[model samples]
Target: MPDRIFDFEKDFAGSLRCIPMAVRLKLDLVGIKLSLRQWSRLDRDQRGRLLEVPCGGAADRHTIGAMIEEWVTATGGTIDRIDPADSANWSNTNTVPEVVVLQAKGEDVSAPSLSQWRALTDQQRFALIKLTRPGHENKNFVPAMREFGLFLAD
Candidate 1:
């Protein structure tokens, strides 16, 4: 599937005001951490290239990795590399994450079932995990769950 900038992110996605989850996932995959402030300093074209660059194979990873390194340097940001773990909560299809469920339950919303969670695309799962993070805005959590058909906000 093509890279996505989800509907909840559309408003800022056009302006790159906030980094899209697709790019965020790619950054995670490549072990780079990009902050929104640093991301905003980049020109629109560069931001667009980041979204367009193929991010699948090892060769593609190298290409985007180099591009991100250049962009980080130009933006006066240092890359804080993180090794993406294969065992992350989002990567686990066997069970739904408790925090996600609790966050939803906090709002009286139902979180996804195991079957539904397992059915989600990695990026979709990533978006949910991100939307539920501590101190990060949880406003989009329900919308995302709805978008993924994992919940119906009543």
Candidate 2:
């Protein structure tokens, strides 16, 4: 699996503070709205499987969703739906989301240009959109930019 955990994960690097992008993508695909609290209740091994499990096909999605559902149930957490607004606009690589641009400006990092956005994979785009949403702490926004190669190390 790709190293989706950013340095901003802080204490979460080992157990994870926030849900990683890889798992988040799967959650979005499966339409499950998971919370940080629920994610924290899971053991390291379960979280690790979420990162390693493939969610690329019908079988994969079914398996991954089942695993997540089981985990949520075991944790006594309920599965919820991801906000549609939070999930859309990822397919249009031609245009960068305004929230991302504003977040980049706040961090003094340049937002990815249209061409750069176009070059990114769908997963990459999804991460940016999710990270830059309103009301998020956004500590990982800069780190994500670096991870995506939109921002360079100082």
Candidate 3:
């Protein structure tokens, strides 16, 4: 990750642009199963626009999920499920979940406060979680934290 927001076009040209973690979040939030290659074909503006679309509030969950599914299907993808509960709720510390816990394995990392994590954009949190995954060679969680502007220099 970089200090700047990820530019899909520049960074992942001619390659499968959707990383597994991002895909997971996208699927969880949008309730879609988008192919990595299909996602790569989308331009930066498209991706940015998707991120800009807010998907919060209790009343809007179903509506938001439907809109996301529509977008995915229109883009040649499919909506696999409608359950938004599967989405990662990084704001919840009491139930950090097994996958996230596994990611923190072997690292002397402290979980940030809910407010701290919530203050970050979804992408930043997603990057941190992905970088912290077990067996991930990069293990660049620290670097990601700094890059996302979540860490200040001493």
Instruction: Give the TM-scores of the predictions, in the order they appear.
Output: 0.88, 0.80, 0.53
Determine the backbone clash count of candidate 1. Answer: 0
* Residue range 1-111, candidate 2, lDDT tens digits: 243554555456546656887788878877788888898888888988887887766687778778888888987788776642334577687689898898899988898
Per-residue lDDT tens digits for candidate 3, residues 1-154, read: 1123443223443233443444345456655555556565566555554445455654444565666566667777765664554434554444544454455454444445555666776656666665655565744665555555554645
Better of 2 and 3 by TM-score: 2
Those runs of model 2 whose alpha carbons end farther than 4 Å from true positions after fitting are 1-3, 7-11, 83-88
Ranking by TM-score: 1, 2, 3
lDDT (C-alpha, whole model) for all candidates: 0.81, 0.77, 0.52
Task: Name the top TM-score candidate.
Answer: 1
Best by lDDT: 1
Q: List the residue pairs that clash in candidate 1.
A: none
Residue-level lDDT of model 1, residues 52-133, one tens digit each, is: 7777767887787888888888777877778853537777898898888888897678878889999998889888888888
Q: After superposition, how far is residue 87 of candidate 2 from its true place, in Å?
A: 6.2
Error of 2 at 154 (Å): 4.1
